[model samples]
Target: MNDHVEKMKLNTKKFASIGIMGLLGLVVIFGSVYTVEEGHIGIVKRFNEAKSQVNPGLHFKVPFVDSVESIEVRTRKNEEKMSSSTKEQMPVTVHVSVNWTVDKSSALDLFRQYGGLTQFEQRILDPRFRSATKDVIPRFEAEQLIQDRATSIQLIENNLIEEMKSFPVVVDNIQIENIILPPKYIQSIETKQTEKNLAAAEEHKLERQRLEALREVNTADAKAQGIVKVAEAEANAIRLKGEAEAAAIAAKAKALKDNPLIVTLTEAQNWNGQLPQTVLGESGMPILDLRNKQN
Candidate 1:
């Protein structure tokens, strides 16, 4: 009985030693090393205080004394929707998107100042972005907000970037997703544009009528001028013909005055078998007595 009791006591001691060794092995295995993933940074903490930063890969730490906290340095995206008023007192809703990442060089300071990436974004970047949208949207009119949307977006982005200059967050891009205006305002704009188009059309019609009237007047004047030219030509032709006839009569009278015998010859050539009772000369005296018949 004494020997069996001693054997049981020795076996209990051996099992206790094995259990202690296993616990120590687990502690050494788990606490000695850490891994940093791709695109991540490991901040090593010794005794609850930050000591150093490690890049992606396998790294060793003091067993049971050191701890590592990882922060993603990869780019991240966040979106916000803002409501604002334009310069014209028009209400608008704007949707905005932001792409950002932790500045690698400023990561330690960032983690030290703020607890983590979430705290920095919540406390700094998001508020500034919202503030920038509110401030910039009011500077432009509603029409400008829609027509020059790209410009407005750029302005907002620039304001956001400037606001974040003192922070460690790197703002990669800011984009305007949508801008919605009131339906009544859109209808009013369309009505005004329609009125303007109608007025322009009326003005164009008047211009066309005026041009047509001018063309008619020009055509009438041209026809009148043609008629006047034809009448003048006819009058000139009549005057020339009268002048030619008068010249011929004058020439014949001069020839008759130069030779009276030509008239006697003309009379003899025209006489028939019957003779006239009297024949008068150029002096109004009887030249031939035909009262007595010639047997």
Candidate 2:
């Protein structure tokens, strides 16, 4: 009975050891196999040194001896606000956005150099972006920055791209979202614009008044010309009527001079059919007394 009890205790100890080993083996297998999701790349690091890079899907590494770091290889966006100055030394605030992506081929090298994405952005990308923005912004005046915002943004993007050429990341695009100017300057510009508009309006009003005055002058001239024409027409008509009357009088005078008996004929034609009561001669005596003969 004592030997059988000792044998049963030994078997129990073996079973426990086997179970523990199996659990450890299971843990190792699960730990060694890792899946890299879509749009991500895995970097295998052995003893804290970057060894290799793996693409998306299941990948194997030595358990407890090697570690995998997954990094997103897809496009990303980051926005930053920077305080800068214009060429005229006007202080301004700029909001900028950047679209960037990690190079999948350079993942291991990037990890070896910068450790991870967070460190990469903090140490390299952020500083470079700030530097590029500050460097390019001072080349433009405040008014130019506001009026030609697209040109200024393009310049900034170019400078940033040039600055980032040596880095492991790809800079897809850069956008300048907003440029904030001083309130007093903005107010002054608005006031100046208002004054300019008012001056233009005043000039337009003066031009309109001048045109109206010119039009009135033209109308007066035309009316005066019409009146002068009417007076000329009336004078011509009067002159023609006087000429006609003078011609008729002259023609009558000529006819009367051509024949002296015209007056007698005219008197005979006008005389009534009646004899005179008395006729007086040069001696003032009655030459013929028709009244006595009739009696």
Pull out the clashing pairs in model 1. none
- Which sections of candidate 1 miss by over 4 Å? 189-295
Please, what are the lDDT tens digits per residue for candidate 2 over residues 1-295? 9999999999999999999999999999998899999999988889988899999998888999998889899998888998989999999999998999998899888998889999999999988888888888899998888888788778878888898899888999888889899999999889988999999999999999999999999999999999999999999999999999999999988999999799889988988977677678888775766665553
- Ten-residue stretch with the least lDDT total in model 2: 286-295
Please give the lDDT score for candidate 1: 0.87
In candidate 1, what are the lDDT values of residues 117-212, reduced to their tens digit? 888889988898899889889999988887787888888889988988888878898788888889999898789889999999999999999999
Candidate of highest TM-score: 2
Which sections of candidate 2 miss by over 4 Å? 193-295
Candidate no. 2 TM-score: 0.65
Clashing pairs in 2: none
State each model's CA lDDT, in order.
Answer: 0.87, 0.90
True-structure RMSD for candidate 1 = 8.2
